[model samples]
Target: MPEVARVVPLPHEVDPQPQRAEVTALLEGGLIRVRLPDGREWDAAWLQAGGSTSIELAAHDWVIVLPPAGGHPAVVMGRIGPSARPPRRHACASRRPRC
Candidate 1:
Protein backbone atom coordinates (compact mmCIF):
# COMPACT_ATOMS: atom_id res chain seq x y z
CA MET A 1 0.00 0.00 0.00
CA PRO A 2 1.12 3.53 -0.67
CA GLU A 3 2.12 5.59 2.34
CA VAL A 4 -0.26 8.35 3.26
CA ALA A 5 1.01 11.64 4.59
CA ARG A 6 -0.45 12.89 7.84
CA VAL A 7 -1.80 16.43 8.05
CA VAL A 8 -0.34 18.52 10.83
CA PRO A 9 -2.15 21.53 12.24
CA LEU A 10 -0.59 24.90 11.71
CA PRO A 11 -0.13 27.47 14.39
CA HIS A 12 -2.12 30.67 14.44
CA GLU A 13 -0.48 33.59 12.70
CA VAL A 14 0.44 36.58 14.80
CA ASP A 15 0.10 40.09 13.41
CA PRO A 16 3.34 41.98 12.88
CA GLN A 17 3.27 45.44 14.38
CA PRO A 18 6.26 47.61 13.53
CA GLN A 19 7.43 50.50 11.40
CA ARG A 20 8.19 49.77 7.77
CA ALA A 21 11.63 50.35 6.28
CA GLU A 22 13.35 49.72 2.98
CA VAL A 23 16.61 47.83 2.99
CA THR A 24 19.44 49.95 1.59
CA ALA A 25 22.32 47.55 2.05
CA LEU A 26 23.26 44.23 3.54
CA LEU A 27 26.15 44.39 5.93
CA GLU A 28 28.43 41.82 7.54
CA GLY A 29 27.32 39.82 10.60
CA GLY A 30 23.65 39.73 9.70
CA LEU A 31 23.34 43.49 9.88
CA ILE A 32 21.43 45.62 7.38
CA ARG A 33 20.97 49.28 6.60
CA VAL A 34 17.44 50.52 6.23
CA ARG A 35 15.72 53.79 5.48
CA LEU A 36 12.48 54.56 7.26
CA PRO A 37 9.53 56.23 5.60
CA ASP A 38 10.49 59.52 7.25
CA GLY A 39 13.90 59.46 5.53
CA ARG A 40 15.97 58.48 8.53
CA GLU A 41 18.42 55.63 8.07
CA TRP A 42 19.66 53.21 10.67
CA ASP A 43 21.71 50.03 10.99
CA ALA A 44 19.65 47.12 12.17
CA ALA A 45 20.34 43.45 12.77
CA TRP A 46 18.31 40.68 11.24
CA LEU A 47 16.83 38.41 13.92
CA GLN A 48 17.66 34.72 13.85
CA ALA A 49 16.98 31.59 15.87
CA GLY A 50 20.56 30.71 16.83
CA GLY A 51 24.18 31.74 16.77
CA SER A 52 24.66 30.32 13.27
CA THR A 53 21.32 31.54 12.02
CA SER A 54 21.52 34.08 9.24
CA ILE A 55 18.93 35.61 6.97
CA GLU A 56 19.78 37.45 3.79
CA LEU A 57 18.16 40.84 3.33
CA ALA A 58 18.23 42.42 -0.10
CA ALA A 59 18.23 46.04 -1.14
CA HIS A 60 14.75 47.54 -1.61
CA ASP A 61 13.16 44.74 0.40
CA TRP A 62 10.44 45.93 2.75
CA VAL A 63 11.11 44.90 6.35
CA ILE A 64 9.48 45.55 9.66
CA VAL A 65 11.73 47.54 11.99
CA LEU A 66 11.37 47.06 15.71
CA PRO A 67 12.59 49.85 17.97
CA PRO A 68 15.14 49.34 20.70
CA ALA A 69 13.82 48.43 24.11
CA GLY A 70 15.59 47.39 27.30
CA GLY A 71 18.95 48.49 25.88
CA HIS A 72 18.97 46.48 22.64
CA PRO A 73 19.67 47.68 19.12
CA ALA A 74 16.80 48.14 16.72
CA VAL A 75 15.91 44.81 15.11
CA VAL A 76 14.75 44.00 11.63
CA MET A 77 11.96 41.60 12.45
CA GLY A 78 11.63 40.08 8.99
CA ARG A 79 10.88 40.90 5.41
CA ILE A 80 7.25 41.60 4.79
CA GLY A 81 5.70 38.51 3.29
CA PRO A 82 2.57 38.07 1.18
CA SER A 83 1.81 35.06 3.34
CA ALA A 84 3.63 33.40 6.24
CA ARG A 85 4.93 29.88 5.86
CA PRO A 86 3.36 27.22 8.05
CA PRO A 87 5.27 25.73 10.96
CA ARG A 88 7.25 22.55 10.46
CA ARG A 89 5.66 19.17 11.18
CA HIS A 90 6.25 17.63 14.59
CA ALA A 91 8.44 14.50 14.84
CA CYS A 92 5.62 12.28 15.98
CA ALA A 93 3.23 13.60 13.36
CA SER A 94 5.03 11.63 10.64
CA ARG A 95 5.43 8.36 12.56
CA ARG A 96 2.98 5.87 11.04
CA PRO A 97 3.59 2.78 13.21
CA ARG A 98 2.58 4.53 16.41
CA CYS A 99 -0.65 5.87 15.01
Candidate 2:
Protein backbone atom coordinates (compact mmCIF):
# COMPACT_ATOMS: atom_id res chain seq x y z
CA MET A 1 0.00 0.00 0.00
CA PRO A 2 2.50 2.55 -1.02
CA GLU A 3 1.84 4.12 -4.39
CA VAL A 4 -0.69 6.76 -3.45
CA ALA A 5 -1.69 9.85 -5.44
CA ARG A 6 -5.36 9.73 -6.17
CA VAL A 7 -7.35 12.88 -5.55
CA VAL A 8 -9.85 11.39 -8.02
CA PRO A 9 -12.26 13.58 -10.03
CA LEU A 10 -12.07 13.79 -13.78
CA PRO A 11 -13.99 11.05 -15.39
CA HIS A 12 -14.69 13.32 -18.36
CA GLU A 13 -14.13 16.76 -19.84
CA VAL A 14 -12.14 18.71 -22.46
CA ASP A 15 -14.51 17.54 -25.15
CA PRO A 16 -14.56 16.82 -28.87
CA GLN A 17 -15.15 13.30 -27.64
CA PRO A 18 -14.20 10.50 -30.02
CA GLN A 19 -11.42 8.30 -28.76
CA ARG A 20 -11.25 4.63 -29.51
CA ALA A 21 -8.54 3.87 -31.99
CA GLU A 22 -7.24 1.71 -29.24
CA VAL A 23 -7.69 4.75 -27.07
CA THR A 24 -5.96 6.91 -29.64
CA ALA A 25 -3.21 4.36 -29.77
CA LEU A 26 -2.87 4.59 -26.03
CA LEU A 27 -2.67 8.34 -26.08
CA GLU A 28 -0.44 8.43 -29.14
CA GLY A 29 1.83 5.70 -27.92
CA GLY A 30 2.92 7.52 -24.81
CA LEU A 31 -0.01 6.39 -22.71
CA ILE A 32 -1.41 9.50 -21.03
CA ARG A 33 0.60 12.04 -18.99
CA VAL A 34 -0.81 14.78 -16.75
CA ARG A 35 0.68 14.33 -13.28
CA LEU A 36 0.62 17.37 -11.10
CA PRO A 37 -0.21 18.01 -7.43
CA ASP A 38 3.01 19.92 -6.78
CA GLY A 39 5.03 17.57 -8.91
CA ARG A 40 4.62 19.88 -11.92
CA GLU A 41 4.06 19.07 -15.59
CA TRP A 42 0.29 19.39 -16.12
CA ASP A 43 0.55 21.17 -19.47
CA ALA A 44 -3.12 22.00 -19.33
CA ALA A 45 -5.52 21.54 -22.19
CA TRP A 46 -8.51 21.59 -19.87
CA LEU A 47 -8.64 21.02 -16.09
CA GLN A 48 -10.62 23.48 -14.05
CA ALA A 49 -11.78 23.17 -10.45
CA GLY A 50 -14.73 25.53 -10.60
CA GLY A 51 -16.35 28.25 -12.68
CA SER A 52 -14.10 30.29 -15.01
CA THR A 53 -11.33 28.86 -17.20
CA SER A 54 -14.14 26.51 -18.14
CA ILE A 55 -13.83 23.45 -20.27
CA GLU A 56 -16.86 21.45 -19.14
CA LEU A 57 -17.37 18.47 -16.84
CA ALA A 58 -20.51 18.65 -14.77
CA ALA A 59 -21.66 15.78 -12.52
CA HIS A 60 -20.04 16.17 -9.14
CA ASP A 61 -17.32 18.36 -10.45
CA TRP A 62 -14.21 19.41 -8.47
CA VAL A 63 -11.02 20.39 -10.26
CA ILE A 64 -8.19 22.84 -9.58
CA VAL A 65 -5.07 24.48 -11.00
CA LEU A 66 -5.57 27.80 -12.77
CA PRO A 67 -1.94 28.80 -12.67
CA PRO A 68 -0.21 31.51 -14.65
CA ALA A 69 0.91 34.63 -12.79
CA GLY A 70 2.01 32.65 -9.73
CA GLY A 71 0.56 29.33 -10.69
CA HIS A 72 -0.56 26.42 -8.51
CA PRO A 73 -3.14 23.61 -8.16
CA ALA A 74 -2.17 20.50 -10.10
CA VAL A 75 -2.80 16.75 -10.46
CA VAL A 76 -4.30 15.67 -13.81
CA MET A 77 -2.56 12.48 -14.75
CA GLY A 78 -4.72 9.52 -15.71
CA ARG A 79 -4.79 5.74 -16.12
CA ILE A 80 -5.62 4.00 -12.86
CA GLY A 81 -6.37 0.45 -13.96
CA PRO A 82 -7.00 -2.04 -16.73
CA SER A 83 -8.39 -0.77 -20.02
CA ALA A 84 -8.72 -2.86 -23.15
CA ARG A 85 -9.74 0.20 -25.15
CA PRO A 86 -12.80 2.43 -24.98
CA PRO A 87 -12.46 6.16 -24.31
CA ARG A 88 -9.88 8.39 -25.86
CA ARG A 89 -9.85 12.03 -27.20
CA HIS A 90 -7.77 14.09 -24.80
CA ALA A 91 -5.86 17.27 -25.62
CA CYS A 92 -2.96 19.58 -24.71
CA ALA A 93 -0.55 19.90 -27.61
CA SER A 94 0.86 23.36 -27.42
CA ARG A 95 4.29 23.19 -25.91
CA ARG A 96 6.80 23.46 -28.69
CA PRO A 97 8.66 26.65 -28.07
CA ARG A 98 12.10 25.76 -26.93
CA CYS A 99 14.28 26.07 -29.97
Candidate 3:
Protein backbone atom coordinates (compact mmCIF):
# COMPACT_ATOMS: atom_id res chain seq x y z
CA MET A 1 0.00 0.00 0.00
CA PRO A 2 1.23 3.47 -0.94
CA GLU A 3 1.08 6.20 1.75
CA VAL A 4 -0.38 9.60 0.83
CA ALA A 5 1.81 12.59 1.49
CA ARG A 6 0.34 15.16 3.83
CA VAL A 7 0.21 18.70 2.54
CA VAL A 8 2.04 21.18 4.69
CA PRO A 9 3.09 24.80 4.55
CA LEU A 10 6.59 26.05 5.12
CA PRO A 11 7.52 28.22 8.08
CA HIS A 12 7.60 31.47 6.07
CA GLU A 13 4.03 31.05 4.78
CA VAL A 14 1.22 32.50 6.87
CA ASP A 15 -2.38 31.33 6.97
CA PRO A 16 -4.97 33.95 6.17
CA GLN A 17 -7.18 34.98 9.06
CA PRO A 18 -9.45 37.79 10.25
CA GLN A 19 -7.58 40.52 12.07
CA ARG A 20 -8.47 43.63 14.01
CA ALA A 21 -6.80 46.68 12.60
CA GLU A 22 -6.71 50.42 13.20
CA VAL A 23 -7.33 52.83 10.36
CA THR A 24 -4.19 54.86 9.79
CA ALA A 25 -5.25 56.95 6.82
CA LEU A 26 -8.09 57.42 4.34
CA LEU A 27 -6.97 57.34 0.75
CA GLU A 28 -8.58 58.22 -2.56
CA GLY A 29 -11.75 56.33 -3.42
CA GLY A 30 -12.65 53.61 -0.92
CA LEU A 31 -9.06 52.59 -0.18
CA ILE A 32 -7.29 53.02 3.13
CA ARG A 33 -4.27 51.95 5.16
CA VAL A 34 -4.69 50.02 8.39
CA ARG A 35 -2.31 48.98 11.13
CA LEU A 36 -2.55 45.39 12.27
CA PRO A 37 -2.22 44.16 15.86
CA ASP A 38 1.40 43.20 15.19
CA GLY A 39 2.15 46.80 14.19
CA ARG A 40 2.38 45.88 10.50
CA GLU A 41 0.54 48.27 8.21
CA TRP A 42 -1.29 47.17 5.06
CA ASP A 43 -3.41 48.74 2.34
CA ALA A 44 -7.03 47.63 2.47
CA ALA A 45 -10.21 48.31 0.54
CA TRP A 46 -13.39 49.52 2.30
CA LEU A 47 -16.23 47.20 1.25
CA GLN A 48 -18.93 47.59 3.88
CA ALA A 49 -20.70 50.66 2.48
CA GLY A 50 -22.51 51.06 -0.82
CA GLY A 51 -23.89 53.74 -3.14
CA SER A 52 -27.19 54.69 -1.42
CA THR A 53 -25.91 55.03 2.14
CA SER A 54 -22.32 55.68 2.94
CA ILE A 55 -20.32 54.76 6.01
CA GLU A 56 -18.14 57.50 7.42
CA LEU A 57 -14.79 55.87 8.01
CA ALA A 58 -11.96 57.84 9.50
CA ALA A 59 -8.46 57.55 10.79
CA HIS A 60 -8.00 56.04 14.27
CA ASP A 61 -11.11 53.91 13.76
CA TRP A 62 -10.94 50.24 14.64
CA VAL A 63 -12.15 47.77 11.99
CA ILE A 64 -12.31 44.09 11.15
CA VAL A 65 -10.08 43.28 8.20
CA LEU A 66 -9.94 40.22 5.99
CA PRO A 67 -6.50 39.52 4.67
CA PRO A 68 -5.93 39.23 0.94
CA ALA A 69 -6.29 35.77 -0.51
CA GLY A 70 -6.26 34.03 -3.88
CA GLY A 71 -5.45 37.15 -5.88
CA HIS A 72 -8.08 39.17 -3.98
CA PRO A 73 -7.12 42.38 -2.25
CA ALA A 74 -7.22 42.96 1.50
CA VAL A 75 -10.65 44.17 2.54
CA VAL A 76 -12.27 45.81 5.53
CA MET A 77 -15.39 44.00 6.74
CA GLY A 78 -16.58 46.81 9.02
CA ARG A 79 -15.81 48.87 12.06
CA ILE A 80 -15.69 47.26 15.51
CA GLY A 81 -19.14 48.54 16.50
CA PRO A 82 -18.89 52.15 17.66
CA SER A 83 -15.34 53.33 17.13
CA ALA A 84 -13.41 53.01 20.35
CA ARG A 85 -10.59 55.39 21.16
CA PRO A 86 -7.52 54.18 22.97
CA PRO A 87 -7.69 54.82 26.73
CA ARG A 88 -6.08 58.08 27.59
CA ARG A 89 -5.06 59.50 30.94
CA HIS A 90 -6.37 62.99 31.51
CA ALA A 91 -5.92 65.61 34.20
CA CYS A 92 -9.31 66.30 35.71
CA ALA A 93 -10.64 67.56 39.01
CA SER A 94 -12.66 64.36 39.49
CA ARG A 95 -9.37 62.38 39.45
CA ARG A 96 -10.68 59.80 37.05
CA PRO A 97 -8.23 57.70 35.07
CA ARG A 98 -9.88 58.11 31.66
CA CYS A 99 -11.54 61.44 32.18
Candidate 1 lDDT over residue span 1-97, tens digit each: 9445443332345333479999998887656888999998878866664432445567999998875443345678788756647799999999888
TM-score of 1: 0.55
Q: Rank the candidates by TM-score, best first.
A: 3, 1, 2
Better of 2 and 3 by lDDT: 3
Q: For residue 48, give model 3's deviation from the true position in Å.
A: 3.7
Pick the winner on TM-score between candidates 2 and 3. Answer: 3
The residue pairs in collision within model 2 are: 34-77, 37-75, 49-63
Ranking by lDDT: 3, 1, 2
> Which candidate leads in lDDT?
3
Indicate which candidate wins on TM-score: 3
Query: Against the true structure, what is each candidate's TM-score?
Result: 0.55, 0.16, 0.58
1 or 2: which has the higher lDDT? 1
